[model samples]
Target: MTSQKLNTFLENNLQELKDNGLYNEIDTIQGPNGSEITINGKKLINMSSNNYLGFANDDRLKVKANEATDTYGVGAGAVRTINGTQSIHDELEAKIAEFKHTEAAVAFQSGFNCNMGAISAVMNKNDAILSDELNHASIIDGCRLSGAKVIRVKHQDMDDLRAKAKEAVESGQYEKIMYITDGVFSMDGDVAKLPEIVEIAEEFDLITYVDDAHGSGVMGKGAGTVKHFGLQDKIDFQMGTLSKAVGVVGGYVAGTQNLIDWLKVRARPFLFSTSLTPGAAAACIEAIDIMSSSTEEHERLWENGRYLKAGLKDLGFNIGDSETPITPCIIGEEKLTQRFSKRLTEEGVYAKSIVFPTVPRGTGRVRNMPSAAHTKDQLDIVLETYKKIGKELDVIS
Candidate 1:
């Protein structure tokens, strides 16, 4: 029983969102979220998942998840600080450290929670964070939660970053400063200027943090964006998600042993929340092993990305300047973008429209995430659908 006023407030806001074409309709997939998904009994080519490596439905990961479940049940039973730190959890952390080329690592229940925990754990009111303007929502929320003075530098503009870092540091108002950016911008599929970021970080003695959620298993031969730039050792915090390219459920921060130790003790989520289930932990470890052992899936992902991008570009869609497979067909108006996405879905493609609040105004786009699991034929179908919808909607000739 909530208050009538609270209910009224929620109803009014929801109605406003619907009227403004900003309310998102959540779709449920009938089976595993793979290259193709079934929604309302209609199968569509899935170009919206973060299953970059196709590990979500991989047989090897399934076997590992089942095996771990048999050995350790479904739940962790308690928070990590209490009794949830099972051997598998520890093993996962060790493998994460190995995979990321860090001295140590710690895991959290989710990517957002990990960022929230990690950012707030080390940064505080006395510190200032020089963040990229295009960093993830999780990163933005984490900074807000950290109570730190946040200065957003223009996205991947190293010169702006340096200026902000210098200003923040010389101001003498903050005890420490951190420069944080995403390893890959998920929305545009553009990579962070890590090399330049690192140079600026060194010049200003700024602690470098990279949230490589979209970079892992897709860049650096499956190591990640920091590793792609060969700056793993220099980054103070290298955070990533097991749910994205790894195709499981969790997140981790790979860093120095001292930093990890501090996070384990201080990160509120790790301290207060139950750990990832044994199945998720084991599946994630196997994912890392797979990523480390082979490059087939990673290569296929990039190949699919290139193919989709090339086809979409050849079809005359305004695909943004993306270095990776996350293709965004920039449809300028919100309602038009939503209509475009709906037409796409009706035509058997499952790409979704991203509008203002998620992206800036007048930059609405239908984002496509090409994964390793998507076949040539499947992609061909997608391309055909896009062309059909593009012409019908007058997005292209």
Candidate 2:
């Protein structure tokens, strides 16, 4: 018994999207998501995953997951404030704090929830947040949920941030001011100017929050961007995800013991949502251990990134300005971008097209995420396929 109005709205929007070539068709990946993936019985090189270190399918993490599952079953059975605060969860938080060089930490179910809970918990209608223009969707939504006056600072523009922070502070309208940004811009693969940001925050006495979802385990020898700039004690909030580089399924905020204590009591998700499973917590702990002990995988990931970027650039593809391992093969037109991605898939590569409004219109791109598990041979095949498809689609010379 669907509402007629809801049905009409859905039908019209769906039809409009299809007509405008804006509809996204999802593909199912069979088996483990690693260097290669299978879709519709076809194996293709995988380059669209966020598994930065290839830890998603690592056997060490798998073994830890299995052991924890056997010992604690599957679920935590209740919210963390209830009876779900297991010892493993405490260990995970402590590990995250130690790894991030923070005084304490609090865990959440997902990165998005971490942002939503943390932002709203500290900020209210009388507060203000200066956010980067290119911050992640989760960050945007979290700012909105906070009921704070959100000032969109230009992406990585330290001058703009300084100006906005000064204005917010002088306005005397807010009880507290905060500046939040992604430690690494995911789409552009650009690192935030943390030293400058810290300076601005210090000048304005603004609270700092860094969502290092893409930077954790990829930057600062696997600590994060804050550590990358030696600002471990400078930032107020060091937020990150276990689902990305850590290759598990949770999020956490590492900061002063006071902040963690407040979040534990105030963040709605931690109060009402079920805690992460024992398996996930243990797997995350193992991933941290592996990262702490070695830089082999980290070095491999960067080497692979450089190799692929060089190959694409030599072939005349419009690879965007990326300072990190994320490579985006930009194709201006939306329909053309979609077609190019489809051709790549057909040619044994599984890189997907990213279009508006994920990115700006006409800046459509096929983003590639090269992982540590990717061999040179597999990357060569991917490059060859990209060459074949890029020429056929007239996306490159």
Candidate 3:
């Protein structure tokens, strides 16, 4: 309980992280997150941001944010349950519901908070959750917090999911069963088999949840994965982040009006946390407008992804089975992956390396997030640098 004792414990854990080369050092970005960014006074081709549609720095979004700030001031001032729920907040939620083609929607402070709030609110101690093995950390934590018996099925293994779902339902021990997955896997860039998953859920009468954090602005013609598979009516929870593809900061859950009503009443984060600012809410509404009106950004993002992935593949680098714009250049060792990232940075690219325990051992990678903002010339530069560093590090032949 002493300060010295706490310091010693922190030091020991910090030392462990350092020894494992997993100590995350925060890098300061001096400018906007875009195709190119400034970090530590150096400019680099940025492939690390989740700004899929480049709306983070977009003029339209900026103008909306400014106008909202001017009209409504800065903060919501209190939690949503109190006086924090502004008209803009309700408008944004309605827009999200419209965009995802759901009956109702509710917004939270962050995407992570939405998962932590919504999942725990619905599935309690008596319920059971069937989660994908590779689901996001937020989902894993949410499941744990729900006090539900969480059973992680193998990633994208429908056979495993079907067997587990059938067994769980037949057992009849739990009050409710929920099946959850990320619509698009972030690291490997593979998409969830939602069509098959939905079929299995229907057969077993399971509640369906899809966290489309990376898929919202990137898939289903910008509506999301549930929309992509035409399973909007089947899914119970269609979760997404306004911060990523939408280029604003917040999270939302779109579902039946009953579900949204339950979350507004029961979700802890919604009840206890302050709502999103007027500016963020307004910017998000504008973002959805842009997403619905044009497919140019989505098309360009896929084009860039194809260009980069093809170039890396032609150079004999192992670009994993990514069906989305997220491309990972898998390097076997942690040290090599880190070294690859460092080399890329020195050569003016900013793709980050992923190592254990973010990923499994021997699956370390330099993950690339190719955005709609990236130009052909920028991608060409990244490719040339990759080839140079790959040759030097022997990552490619």
Candidate 4:
């Protein structure tokens, strides 16, 4: 029997969420998540996965992973501070630093943990973090963990960031100030004004941090957003994930050798958790190698994105201003957005609806992530389905 107090809390909160149309109903995918996926035995054109380059299902990655498992076994065996630091792990970290053009790099169990560990490791109550309002949830939690005064600057507003930086610096209330932002804003698919951000960082002598989770292998010809702007040396922290475009499961912070060394000892996740599997580490290295060697996947991704975006726009859907391939079909009402997503699924498309408080109330949308593996015909089918649904729902005239 469950405790009344605990049960009541769960039941009431969940009920409230459902009542407000904020409850998320998860769909079970039967097989690998790629350009196409099966849900409840129904195959759909997948537009909701972060497999930007389709590396997750690539045969090359599978071979590398299989080879690593055969050579090193499945798990890392222990926490990184113990016996988990395999040679492949070291090799992966070296490649991360090389790919990002940093002096050193350190890997973590996940991107969320990377932010949580890296932020708290360096920042403290003696510091202040000037974060963009649209920064990821992990970044928000990481700031809270740091015990620092977090000042939220307006999203992509350089003037506001500059003003906040000036005020934070002149206040003299903190010993150190850091400016952190997402290299690519996930929801709106817009890019952070990194050049302006770096200039402001220089003027304020602020530590620069960028979480390029969405930008890796998608921007800078697969290098990242920092490399996109050629401001890598100006930024202090470059955090990214191996799970997204890299097609593996891990995260890394690339910076100076001292920063990597400090994180190795100071980052709680690194010290407390087992390192990435040998297979994942090996696959990550090969993925980077593939990206560096050829631009086929990168070019294919952008082509698909442009094709999808152009088609959506031609159909009179509001895709917003996306600098990346992430497309959002903005629907004004939460319930309507959910219904639209349902309709899309019914029509053999698998785009997910995002509503408040994920994207602010009344600005709900069906977020579409087009991957490189999607054929033009598959995308056209998606487009045709979307058009029918939009017309049926009166979302477009």
lDDT of each: 0.93, 0.94, 0.93, 0.94
> What residue runs in model 4 are displaced by over 4 Å at the alpha carbon?
none
Error of 2 at 393 (Å): 1.0
Which regions of candidate 1 deviate over 4 angstroms? Answer: none
lDDT per residue (tens digit) for residues 1-397 in model 1: 8799999999999999888888899999999999999999999999999999899999999999999999999999999998999999999999999999999999999999989999999999999998899989999999999999999899888778888888888889999899888998988989998888788888889998999999988899999998998988889999999999999999999999999999999999999999999999999999999989999999999999999999999999999899988899999899899999999899889999999889998999999999999999999999999999999989999
- Using Cα atoms with residue i matched to residue i, what is each candidate's TM-score against the true structure? 0.99, 0.99, 0.98, 0.99
- Number of the top candidate by lDDT? 4
- Please report how far candidate 1 places residue 68 from its true position, in Å: 0.6
Q: Which candidate model has the greater lDDT, 1 or 4?
A: 4
Steric clashes per prediction:
0, 0, 0, 0
As for candidate 2, its clashing pairs are none
RMSD of each predicted structure: 0.9, 0.8, 1.1, 0.8
Give model 2's clash tally: 0
Candidate 4 C-alpha lDDT tens digits along 153-207? 9989999999999999999999999999999989999998999898899999999
lDDT of 3 by residue, 150-212 (tens): 999999999999999999999989999999999999999999999899899989999999999
Worst 10 residues of 4 by lDDT: 15-24
